[model samples]
Target chain A: MNAIGLVAFALVGSAKAIRAEFDLFGVTVVGLVTAFAGGATRDVLVGRVPLALQNVGEVALGLLGVCLAVVLYAWLEAPDDRPITLYADAIGLAAFATAGAIVAIEIGLPAFGVVAIATINAVGGGAFADLLLDRSPFILFEDFYASCAVLGGSAYWLFTALAADATLAAAACATVTVGTRVLALSRGWTVPTAQRLEAVTGE
Target chain B: MNAIGLVAFALVGSAKAIRAEFDLFGVTVVGLVTAFAGGATRDVLVGRVPLALQNVGEVALGLLGVCLAVVLYAWLEAPDDRPITLYADAIGLAAFATAGAIVAIEIGLPAFGVVAIATINAVGGGAFADLLLDRSPFILFEDFYASCAVLGGSAYWLFTALAADATLAAAACATVTVGTRVLALSRGWTVPTAQRLEAVTGE
Candidate 1:
């Protein structure tokens, strides 16, 4: 939970629109939302009655994410904030993607469903929070966010097939997700624009 | 869905504030938010992946609720819109409460957990939307909104204990909830307030 909290704090920090001039409160709120909201959302969707309700540790993790965001932000006060936010976001994405997949698998979802659920669970809260905050989702704008998640899940899927093991799948998937995200951002590599943009926004 | 939509529509039509100046788009957006946001929120909280992704019907119901609000506003054009908003709030509370409890029960949560989830699922979204929209949640101020949901889940719990005996529990619970809400409003009965007021305006 502590590890995940740190990752989630970074993810939410990255997703915020730095131009929005958010205070510490707003930053903490975003972190809380992105980290807890996804798992909480998963619980509601699965009708598990919110694991957080039963698990004090999960609740503590959420609070931890908010605290970390504030502390981390203060520590990284600089001319360039992007580097700090990017690394944080990457950590969050990897942790959540792996966590989501594992949860799904444990709950007896099929592999496809597990992968899909994991991908969404990892990204959904941050995406929704960013939307609510009136910021374009980092995934939809610049970063190859979804692609990396997909790749991570695919790696997990492949590793699990090879070994018929959950631990290896999760570790491999998370590592792939983080490394791929870093590479994508550093190289400015992207999935080709299959979506028709000129046709989307008419003048 | 149609019945709920009709109720939602009538609630909107009955609001004088909305009819006075707000456009069709604004009214519809409010209605949609009022009707669907609760259920969407419930789904998000429960980790109900399929519910979120596959329940296209819920979206349709939301659209219906929005349309109902639009038509109702255009036709009734009522005065003192307070009652209308109250009714809409009630429906949102009831519908979301029902969904939350049912999902909790379906997922095999214990009675205590179901009740808690139902209560939160019922009110959380409205509270959030209100917070986002910069308004107070109705549950905190008027009507037996949260209480009704808790009672309703209790009924469901009791019913299950009675071995699915289609007895008075379910109906009684529903009646208690709805009746308490309407009665509280009709009589202007409020939670006791002794020294509730603060020194500052809006305090």
Candidate 2:
């Protein structure tokens, strides 16, 4: 599951790097950070050395994903459009949200704790990647991005707290996140910008 | 020492936010993240719940720093210039570097681990703030920033490993980091950018 998420995250990171026209080294750096930073953040908060640092396999998988992204970039004539990027991001978000929430739950964190960890873990990598590239983090404004993670994480915590089956809870978490994201994309839903509020207040 | 670093970091973050024309909430968010993110990152990687989350005093200190920054901004007619910002940054870097190195050493991390953790803890907050504001992270290109952290961390580790007194080692670490940064500023030292390599390699 983590390996799959790594690939998805790498692709998202790589695409962003390519859009920024970063060199190969830059691409790899961005991809690796995006793929591992979330889990690393989670592990660090839990008082464990990040698996990304301890496990050779995780690092290798991240590298493989970056290399594959580079290869794909070389092969493709055109850059990816918005839809493809959003979909990939959604998938990665759901994966990490479920994974992070479960970890939080296992540690007996409260509902808020579970949601916070899950949301941060799901989106933190992309945020790090964007920040490194000198862009405003996507989580700050990207449509339904961190929101999905929050909702999914909360749902997961709710289900688990209510004595739901583990697999069932996990599935529900993933489904809600992905489904909300897809709907938000199709419906053009967005978290309102502060600019709108300022205009309304006329301040 | 950590509290001082937190306050200093909040000032830096708040200054950046003011420069970016962020509203009050944005300023507070940026300030809090800047003050806490470094230590939080360190704690998380070490598999411990972050002190920022666990300790009420720490949170209160962080808030106080942000409020102070906001008040300062309101009182001041002009935003800070580059030199003032750099000087404040240098102080923060020195403090966090020494503290982080001590923690890493006490935890029995290897020399490399000590350096990694120390350097990251020293500069991670500023990096996060820069990224959030859509500016290049200072450590990536700022004169002798992370380099100072590396040197300081290594110096601390070496001193401790060689049976030097703890206070003396910490003083040496801070002095080296701040002294180097000050010298770098006075001497107009800058990190050599990769763009220079592009010119040489014609890539």
Candidate 3:
């Protein structure tokens, strides 16, 4: 699960860097950051050394994703906005969110902490990458992306509270997160902004 | 030291949010994040709950800074570029960097980790605030800001290596960091970028 998340996020991040016309070094840095940052942040919040630093295999997997992205971009000329990357990103998000939720629960965090950490673990890398690209984080204002993690985290908490099996709870969490993200992607779903709310109210 | 750093960073962050035309809630969020994020990050790296969350006084100090910023902005109409704010920011940077270095040493981190965590603790908040404001972090591509922390951290390690007293080492770290920052601000020193280097080399 960790490997999948690392590779997918690295690919997604490298694609963004490529689209932004960054140099090769910049692309690799951004990809590595995207792949490791979310999990690193989760580990930090839980008071542990980031797993990326401890495990050489994790870095290798992230680098593999970066290489794949560079090759794919070279072949396709522009793969960032394509469906393949989007689907990979969705899967990565679910994997990370579920992983974070399990960790938070294992560490005996409160429900709010669990959900918050899960969401952060899911979207933190994309947010960091967006910052590197000199833009507002899409999770903050523009996308329906993070909401899926929030909902999935809530579901995980609910299942745990109801004494569900750990594996069952994990599966439900990932399924809900990925399902919602894919549906949102296909249906153009977006969270309403303050401006949209004001317009709706005619105020 | 934490109190001073928290208040100063909060004021600086709130001022930035106001200049960006964020609403009151946005300003508050930015202010709190800028004040707390660095310290929180430092604590997390060293394996502890953030002091801000653990202590009510810390939150109050940060809020005081936010309120002060809002009031000052309303009165002066444009105080973001004022010298007072710059000096306060420098102090905050030094205080946070010294604090982080001390923690890293206490935790027996290597020299690299000490320097890295110190720099992150000093500038993490500003970087985060910049992200929320939809801009690339100033630390990444501009300013002589983070380098001051790096130098300070190195100095701290050197002092400790020479078997200096912990208090003296911390004082030296803070002094070096703030001294360099103030000098740089007055002299208009900036770290050169790739473009500048290329231009200089006539490449």
Off by over 4 Å in 2: A1-4, A52-68, A71-79, A82-85, A161-165, A193-195, A201-203, B1-31, B42-47, B53-127, B134-203
State in Å the error of residue A172, model 3: 2.1
Candidate 3, residues A87-163, lDDT tens digits: the string is 87888889999988998899877676677678878888877888888876667555578888988888898899999
Cα lDDT tens digits for candidate 1, B172-194: 44555566667766777554211
Candidate maximizing lDDT: 3
| Global Cα lDDT for candidate 1 | 0.59
The better-scoring model by DockQ among 2 and 3 is 2
Q: List the residue pairs that clash in candidate 2.
A: A44-B44, A44-B45, A45-B44, A47-B47, A47-B48, A48-B47
Scored by lDDT, model 2 comes in at 0.78
Poorest stretch of ten by lDDT in candidate 2 chain B: B73-82
Per-residue accuracy of model 2 over A38-145 as CA lDDT, tens digit each: 988887777666888888988887887787777777777433344665576678789999999988888777765687688878988988898778777756654656
Alpha-carbon RMSD, each predicted model: 9.1, 7.3, 7.0
The TM-score, computed over Cα atoms with residue i paired to residue i, of candidate 3 is 0.62
lDDT of 2 at A33: 90
- Higher-scoring candidate on lDDT, 1 or 2: 2
Query: What's the lDDT for residue B12 in model 2?
Result: 71
Of candidates 3 and 1, the better by DockQ: 3
lDDT of 3 by residue, B118-182 (tens): 99899998888887898778788877899999999988998999999999999999999999999
TM-score of chain A of each: 0.75, 0.87, 0.94
